[model samples]
Target: MVKMLCDPVCPPPNLSQHPCCTVKCWKWDVNQITMNNLVKYGILILNRPITQNSGFIKNLWNRATIRMTVDGGTRQWDKFISGLSNEMQTTIKDPDLISGDFDSITDEILEKYKAKGCKVIHTPDQDRTDFTKAIMELNTHRKQTGLELSHIIAVAQTSGRFDQIVGNIQTLFLVKEELLLDPNTNVFLISDDSITWLLMPGDHVIYIPEETRQHKRAWCSLVPVGETCKYCTTTGLKWNLDNQSLRFGGIVSTSNTFDGSEKVTVKCSHTLMWSMRLPTIAIS
Candidate 1:
């Protein structure tokens, strides 16, 4: 039983902090079957990594109902087709929506997708990142249908300008803030080997599915990104947090090993991020 000493400004401590809360159980009210599975979520493929990726990319391709591309990501989609055989190319699905500042995507690709019944919405707002625009689109669509998205898997390569990579991380938090009241909305940054997502304030349990494990050990991390997470605790992790405060320039949980723990639980005083090394299995 992990007890919490809550910050005054933060809500009253979750009395139901795992083994002993009387008010509410600290468990997420989501179906265990869909937890960490991509089919239940949405996929937003950005240009870089998805464009340069193959094989492993085939694994997570068709799991989401909502599919969209960001800016040059459309160009990347068309480029991806170039690398596939005629049979493989026919199986590729164009995004339902292509959104961005209309800079990187080629006119040819736009014509192609539009011809295939895809909607292309161009926003000339240079004020925000294309990633942000894409997120806004998702938020709006979900709100209209009153459908809560299971999660978001953002596919983008970090092999770019230093600031761009940092901006991508910022995109995660920014979208969370935009959908401020929706606590269940999850956004994940995924590349080839790394996956990351924010663990908002309160209790969080990361369920390790059997399919996500390819070896005996996998690595996971928790870092206080926006503000310091005070009085945080975790279990089912090799180096468990014992009422620790995580922040930069201070103690942080990084490269922690997840050695066959079926469930990892975490509770924080404020919003923070949870990152982990994704399994390398080819999920066909």
Candidate 2:
């Protein structure tokens, strides 16, 4: 008999002898929701300001295998790293690709990365934002040249202009069609304070990483995001839903805590945007 993904038990225990044993069952995409099942994806750093000491940046930098920058993002990165020690400055964090409309990336920033053997691509299309162009490039390469990318983690602040925030969310909707080749390609928008992602029209389970939920009261909110989400059911949230209809002006779930649960599951008719607070260090 074939053992199911959750056979034996949930979240395989890490053996002391083999530290990497914690990565068991990570290769299978259909495995039960767990932090060990996190898929490797290319990191897309946006132009938004991200300080060097940001926990979100620290986490992604260690996790992502590939890194790319969007337009003026290089400027933000350059400025951020410049404040570090000389040893850290000497250690290069060269991006594999820097893409945008060329309006945001300064000439100095481009020259600096170019000297470090970075591939700077100038997409002059005015029809789309640099954010959208980056996605298109990722999709194009995936289809034509077999660029291996499971998904994308976009690191841009939510404190930017309201229009910019909407535009970033729009990319999530547009990329849905392009990523149909892989159902596990979940794109997430992460920042210093929170993480936001779109849950499709099916059962969705979000595994909160151990490091992200320790001793922190995380508030999660669900929004339809430009559509009326109907008949949604959820478990493991403070305000659990049961076949509920949520709309922009009608009913939306906000300020809902996680109730100290490791996993939050939602089944919905329409795609709903899920936003959760980031666990942070308490500075007394």
**C-alpha local distance difference test of each model:** 0.67, 0.67
Tens digits of per-residue lDDT for model 2, 96-166: 78899878777988998999998888899988788888877766656675655655778787786989999
Look at candidate 1 and give me any clashing residue pairs: 15-21, 16-21
lDDT of each residue in 1-284, candidate 1, tens digit only: 12111111222222234334222123432222223233456778887745323555544555566788888988876777687888877776768888998888778878988999988888789878888888888777778778656567678865787777788888877765655324455667776666676666677766665544435557778889878888788888888998899889999888787656676788777777777655543222
TM-score of 1: 0.79
Candidate 2 stretches greater than 4 Å from native = 1-39, 52-59, 143-145, 178-183, 210-217, 280-284
Residue 157 of model 2: what lDDT?
Answer: 76
Worst 10 residues of 1 by lDDT: 1-10
User: TM-score for every candidate vs. truth?
Assistant: 0.79, 0.80
Off by over 4 Å in 1: 1-40, 51-59, 144-148, 180-183, 210-217, 281-284
